[model samples]
Target chain A: MFLNETQEEVRNTTRNFVNAVIRPAAEALDREERFPSEIYEEMGKLGLFGIAVPEDLGGPGFDTLTYAVVMEELSRGYASIADQCGLVELISTLLVRHGTPEQQKMLPDVMSMKRKVAYCITEPEAGTDVSGIRTTAVKDGDGWVLNGGKIWIHNAPVADTGFVLARTDKEAGNRGMSIFIVDLHAKGVERGPKEHKMGQRASQVGALGFSEVRLGPNALLGEMNRGFHMMMSVLDKGRVGIAALAVGIGQAGLEAAVDYAGTRKQFGKQISEFQGVQWLLADMAKDIEAARLLVYSAAMKIDRGLDATRSCSMAKCFAGDMAVARTADAVQVFGGSGYIRGFEVERLYRDAKITQIYEGTNQIQRMIIARELLRKGATS
Target chain B: MKILVPVKRVVDYNVRVRVRPDGSGVDLNHVKMSMNPFDEIALEEAVRLREKGIATEIVAVSIGVPQAKDTLRTALAMGADRAILVKSGDDVSQDLEPLSVARILAKVVATEKPELVIAGKQAIDNDMNATGQMLAALLGWGQGTFASAVRIDEGSALVTREIDGGLQTIRLKLPAVVTTDLRLNEPRYVALPAIMKAKKKPLEELALADLGVDTRPHLTVVSATEPRQRQAGVKIQSVDELLSKLKNEAGVI
Candidate 1:
C-alpha cells in the first residue's frame, strides 16, 4: 500500500549520516581547497560511494530511486559529493549496461572507494555538443593509442581512472565517437592545473591530456561505432544526478539562511521575527521542496526503467536555476557575512553556477524536452 | 574476547512519535524504526574493538517482532560478526514495562555465552533505562550502566560510567553487561560494502516457542494521547516587546 517504505528509509538514513558526518567537514574542505578526503574515506567505508552497485558487488543493491535518495542526502551535505556520484554512477550506468563482463566487475571496486574515477566528455571545443571532440583514440595492435585532450573533467587529477570520449574516425563524424575507460596513471596521460572554479571548489575539476597514451583492448567501453548513441542515450539519469546536487546546494543555502535569521539579532529582535525575512525564508523552503520533488520524481522513474528523459531534463534545469537564485537570496539573508569566501552560503552561491553549465547544459535540456514533445506530436 | 552487544530497534529519534487522542496505545503502524541511538553507540564500541583486534566475534542480537531483523542488518552493516532475532508477537507490548525485553535478552546471553553484552541506557521512546541492568541481574552477571568509555585489556574491561556530576570508572571481570549513555562516541555510518554484505549476514529468527518464553498480552493501556500543547504566546516585533516576552511572557530571558 505504501509507495515502497524501504526506499524512503534508505533516503532518511543517508540524509542523517551526511548531516552529522559530512556537513561539518564540507566548509572546511572548501575553505582549505583540500579534497574532502576524510568524507570520501568515511563515505567509502559507509558504502556511500557504491549506492547503486549490486549487493553482490559490494553495493547496497539499491534501485534507481534508492540511488537517487542516497545522492540527494549526500548532496544535501555538499554538492561536491553529487558531482562524484554523477561521474561514478550516472555515466557509469551506460558502461554497466553495455560494458563487457570484465568492465562490469570493475564497478564494485570503484564503489568500494578503494579506487577513484573521473569523467571527461567536455572539451574546450565541445561543451554542450559532444560531437566536436578532437580527442582521438586510434586502434593499435589489440589496443588503442589515445591523443588530443579534454578539459572541464570532474576529478581529473586525483582519479585513477576515467571515461574519456574521443573521436575514432574523422570521416564518420558523430559515428566516429567512442568512449574509452583510460587509466589516468598511464604514461603519456597528464593532468592539467586545477580550474579556477566559481563554486564547488571541494570537487577537483580540471583538464586531462593524452599524448598517444596506450590503452588495453578492454578499454573500449561499449560498441565502437555506437559511441555517439552511447553518450546520448537520453543522458536523463545524469541530469537527475546533477539536479539532486543543485537541490543540495539550495537546501544548504536555505538552512543557512533560516539558521542565521533565527539567531542574528537586528534592532534587538531576531531577524526571523520580521515578516519580510519570514516571507523570503518561506519562498526558499518552498523552492527547495518543489525542486526536491521534481528531482526525486525523475530518479524514481529511472528506478522503474521508464522513459523519464523529459522529466529528468526539467528537474535538472529547474534545480540548477533554483540553486543559483536561492543561493543569491541566501547571501542576501546573511548580508555582509555571506559575501566572504568561507561562509557556506558564499560557497553555495559560487558552487551553484556550474550545475547549469555542466551535464549537457540547461539550454540543451530545453532542446531535449522540446524534441521529446515534438516526437510525441504533443506540440502544435 | 567475544563480545555480545544487544542492539534494540526503537522508533527513529528524528521522527516525532504521534500518539492517538483518547486511544488505547501509541500508534505504531507505519512508524519509522531505527537502532536505538544509545544502543548504536554500544554497537559502535563493540565493532571498534573487534576492528582493532582487541576482540573477536562481536555477536549482535535484538528482541522484538520478526522485523527486528532490520536492526540486525544495521549491526551487521556496522561490522558486527553476526546477529540473532528473538521474535515475539504483538503481545510483546504487554510485557510489564522493561521485564519482557530484559527477559528475552537474558535468554540470548545464556545461549551465546559471550564475555560482554553492551546495551543502551535507554531507548529514546520509552526511556525506561531498565533492560540492561535487569538482563544482567537475570543472568547473574555484573552490570555497568551509562558507560561513556569502555576499554578492554587482558581479561578485564575498564568502563567509565557518566553520572550527573562527573564520571566513575570500574574494573569488571568477563561476562559483564554495559549500558551506554548519550556521551559515548558518535556511531559510524555503515559503509557501502557492509550494507551489501549485511544482507548476506546470518540472521536467525526465533519465535517465542523457540526461546521458551510466552509472548502474551498481560498489560493494556487505558488511553493514548499526545503531549500537551503549549499556550500561544503574544507576537513580538519591537526590541522592547522581544525583551518583555523573553523575561515576563516566556520567563527565560
Candidate 2:
C-alpha cells in the first residue's frame, strides 16, 4: 500500500506498455504459439529487465517490490510474456549476486534481451528432489564436460545461454552439485522438440540435451559443490515472482467474471443479480486481495534484505491455489461461453493452471512452508 | 539558443470526468492528474530541437499548485534540462486561468530571456486556447498557433500551422511563441531509468509574489453544468414517416 513514487511510476509504465503493446498481440501469439521476440526486445529497451538490478550494472536498481509489480502488470496482459521476464530476472539476479567479473559482463545483453538464458535445474528424473539430478559436469582439461539432459526447461528452444546445475561430485548428494553457464549453441548440445502444453503456449518450452558439452573454466557460476544452496536462494525470489504471476492471473479472471456476469442475461436478468453468482464473485475478490497482500509482503521482505524463504513459499502456495480456483470459478461465471475459445477467460483458465504446477508445484510449496513452520515454531 | 516550454497538469485523458452535482465544477478528488497531452507534444518538439543541436538549453515552466511539481518532473524526465514551478497556492483557483498563466509566464520570459517559447495550443481542462497568444502579446513578439511543424535557422523560425481552411506557414523572429497542435509529433515513453535520473535535475519553485505578477481572474465561471443528455431515437416506419418527422418534429425540411 505504501509503494513509493518510483515504484508507482514503474507500475504505471509497465501497465501502459502492457495495454498498448502486449494485449493486442497476446491472443495471436497464443494462437500461433509464437514467441513475441520484438516485444521482449522492446521491453529490454524500456529497461523493464533492469528493474531489480543496480543502476551501474545497466539496470534501474529497483527493489524486489518493483520487480513484483512489473511481473503482475505484465502478466495481466499475458502470462507467457511475464514468464519470460521472470526467467530473465531469475538469471540476472543470480549473476548480479554471485557471478564473477567475466560472468557479470553478460548483464547488459541479458537485460536487453539480446541474449536469453534459461534456468536448468529440473532434469528428467529430478522434479522435486534436487539430489536426484544426474546431470554430471565432470572436470575435463581446463574445462568441464556436461553429459545429462534437463526437461521442462522454460525458454530452452530460444535460449542462448543456460544457468545449469550439474553433479560435480557424485558422493556429496545435493551438495555435490555445481552450477555452470552453458552455451546452448555449443557442440554436443541438442534441443529436443518443443513440449506441447495446455496453456502458456506462447512460451518456448523444451528439453535440452548435453552430450559432453564442453564449458570453459570461467563458465562455473557461484561455487562448485554449492549450486544447491545458490539455487535454493534463487528459488526463494522465484517463488515471489510466481506469486505475483498468480495474482495477475487471478485478477484477470475476477475482472472477466464480473464483466461477463454483469452483461450476460440468464433467467430474465443479468446473472450478476443472482445470490450464487454474487457469492462466487465476492469470494474470488476476497481471495485475490489476500493473495496480493501475501505476495507483496514477501516481496517487501526480500527488498528489505530480510530472509523470505518461508513467506515466499506461503505466498506462492496461496496465490497459486487462488489462481487455479478463481479461474475455474470465472469459467463457471461465463457458463457455456467460458468453455469456448475466443473468450479471454477461456485462455486465462488454461494459463492459470500452470501457476500451481510449475515453480515448485503447490505441493512442494506446502512442504517448504510446513518445514519452515516446524523449524521456527510458528513465529507468525 | 534557449527554449522555454510551459506545461499544465490536467486530468488524465483516460479518466471519465464527472461534473459536480452542485454545479460548482468537475470533481477532482482522488482523480489521476497528468501532463496535458498537447504539452507533451510541445515538449517533444523542444526536446527534438535540443537533440538536433539547434537549441543549447531547454527550460520547462509550470504554473499551478504545489502538486504541479510532478508535471514538471515528468518534463525533466522527458529530457528538459531544468524546470521552474510558479506556485499559485491552493486557494487561488482563478490564478490558473489562461490570462493569469500568461502573465506569470511573461514574467518568466522576461527574466529567463529564452529565444523561443513553446506551449500547448490549449489545456485539456479549460480548452481556452489563449495562453500562447497572450504571452506573445504581453512580450510584444510574433506568435504561431496550432503549429504542426517548426524549422529554425539563425534568428528566424518557420512554423507550419494547421488552420480551418488548410495549412498556413509563418516566419517569426528569433524570440517567438509557438503552440503545438495534435499532429506536431509523438512523445516518447519516459523510461524508469530516465525518471530516476530526472530526480537529480534542477527543479526550482517560486511563488507568484516573487515573480511580481498579479494572478487575479480575468474570467468567471458563474456556474458549471453538464451537457444535456440526448433522448433515445425512434425508428421510422417508412420514407413518408421520415419526411413527416423531419418536417414537423425536427424542422429540418
Candidate 3:
C-alpha cells in the first residue's frame, strides 16, 4: 500500500505498457494458445525481470512489494505474461540466494531476458511431496550424469537454461537432492510437446526428460544436499508471486464485472442497479482487497528478512480461492454473453483455476498454514 | 546537433477530470499526474533523432512544481541525456501560460545553446497550442508546428506539418522550433532498468527567479464547469413531426 516513488513509477510504466501492448494482444494470445515472445522481449527491455533482483546483479533492485505490484498490474492484463515474469524471478532469486559465483553469473542474462530459465522441481511423481522425486544426478568422473523427468514445467519448451532438482543421494530423502543449472540445449535433454492448458495458455508448459545428461561439477547450484532447503526458500517467494498474480486476475474479473453490470440491462434497468448484482460486486471487491493485503504483507515480510512461510501460504490459498470465485462471478455478470469464447471474463474464468493448483495446491497451502500454526502457535 | 525538448506534467489523460466545487480549478488532489501525452510525443521525436545519429545530445526541460521532476525523470528514462526542472512552487494559481513557459525556456536555450528545440504542439490539460510558436518567436527562429514527420540534414530540418488542408512540409534552419503532432513516431516504452538509470542521470532544478523571468497569469479563468449532459433522443413517428421539431424546438431547419 505504501509504494515508494520508484515503485509507483514502475507501476505506471508497466501499466502503460500493459495498456498499449499486452491488453490488445491478450485475447488473441489466449485464443491461439501462443506465447507472446515480442511482448516478453519488450518487458525484458523494460527491466520487469529485474524488479526484485539486486542492482549489482544487473537488476533494477526493487523491493518485493514493487515486484508484487508489477506482477499484479501485468497479471491484470494477462496472467500468462505475469507468470512468465514470475518464473524468471523465481530462477533469478534462487540463483542470487543459493547459486555459486559461476551459477550466479547467469543473472544478467536472465534479467535481460537474453536467456530464459525454468524451475524444474515439480515432477510427475512429485508435486506436493517433492521428496518423492525420482530424478537422479549420479557422480561420474568429476561430472554428474542426470537421468530423470520433470512435468508441468513452465517455460520448459522455450527455456535456454533450467534449474533442475535431482537426487544426489537417493537414501537421504529430501536432503539427497541438488539443483543443477542445465543447458537445456545440451545432449540427452529432450522436451515433450507443450501441454494444451485450459487457460493462461500464453505460457508454454511441458515435460522435460534428461537421459544421462552430463553436467560439470560447476553446474551444481547453491550447495549439494541443500537443494530442498533452497527450493523451500524459493517457494516462499513463489507463493507470494502467485498470490499477487491471483489478485491481478481477481482485480481484472472485478473490473470486468463492474463494467458489464453497469452497461448490460436486464428488465429495463442496469444489472448494477440490482441489489443481487450489487452484493456480488461488493463481495468481490472486499475479497480482492483482503487478499491483496495478505499478499503484500507476506511480500513485505520477505523483503524485511522476516519469516513469511505461514503468511505466504495464507495469502496464496485465500487469493487463489478468491480469484476462482471472483472470475466465476464475473462470467455470471456477463450472463450468456460471458459463456462465449471471445469474452475476456470467460477466459479469465478459465485461467483462475490454475492459481489454486500451481506453486503447491491450495490444499497444500492450507496444510502448510495449519502445520505452521500448530508448530509456532498463533500470534494474538 | 544538440536538441532541447520541453515537457509538461499534466493530469494523466485516462483520468476523468472533475472541476472543483468551489470553481478554483480542476480537482487535482490525489489525482494521478503524468507527462503530457503530446510532450511524450515530442520527447519521443527528440530521442529518435538522437538514435538516428542526427542529434548528439538531448536536454529535456520541464516547468512546474517540484513533482515535475518525476516527469523529467520519465523523459530521461525515455532517453533524454539530462534534465532541468524549473520549479514553479506549489501555488496552482500561477498562470504558467505558454508565453511565460516560452520565456523561461528561452533563457534555458541561451544557456544550453541547443541547435534545435522540439516541443509538443500543446499540453493536453490546457490544449493552448502556443508554446512552440511563442518559444520560436522569443528565440527569433523559424517554427514548424504540428510536425508529423521530421528529418534533419545539413544544418536544417525538414518537417511535415498536419494542417487543415493537408500535410505541409517545411524546412527550418538549424536552431529552430518543431512541435510534435500525434503522428510523429510512437514513443517507446521506458523500461524499468532505464528508469533506475534515469535516477542517476543529471536532473538540475531551478526556480523561476533563477531564470530571471516574470511568472504571472495573463488570463483569468471564470467558473470552471462540466459540460451539459445531452438527453437521450426519441424516435420520430413521421416526417411531418420531425420537420416540426426541427423547425420549432431544435431551430436547425
Q: Highest TM-score among the candidates is held by which one? A: 2
| Ten residues in sequence with the least summed lDDT for candidate 1 chain B | B88-97
* Residues B180-224, model 3: lDDT tens digits: 999998888888888789889999988778778976778778888
Candidate 3 reaches a DockQ of 0.68
Total clashing pairs for each candidate: 9, 0, 2
Arranged by lDDT, best first: 3, 2, 1
TM-score of chain B of 1: 0.86
Q: Taking the tens digit of each residue's C-alpha lDDT, what string does model 1 give over A1-380?
A: 22354564466567778878778877887776667766676666566765666655556667666666677677778788767766778545675677788887778667655578887788888888777889998889999999988887888868888888889888998999888988899999999998767667778888999998999989998989678888777377778878888888888899899999998999989999999889888888999888888888888788778788888998999999998999899999999999997788988898899989888789988898899898876632
Tell me model 2's lDDT, rounded to 2 decimals.
0.89
Q: Tell me the tens digit of each residue's lDDT in model 2 across A31-124.
A: 8899898999899988877577888888888888888988988998999999988998989989998999889999999999999899999987
Could you give candidate 1's per-residue lDDT for residues B24-84 as a string of tens digits?
Answer: 6665668778888888898888888888888899888887776677788878878788898
The Cα local distance difference test for each model comes to 0.80, 0.89, 0.90
Q: Give the higher-lDDT candidate: 1 or 3.
A: 3
Candidate 2 reaches a DockQ of 0.62
Q: Which DockQ values do the candidates obtain, in the order shown? A: 0.37, 0.62, 0.68
Model 1 has a clash total of 9
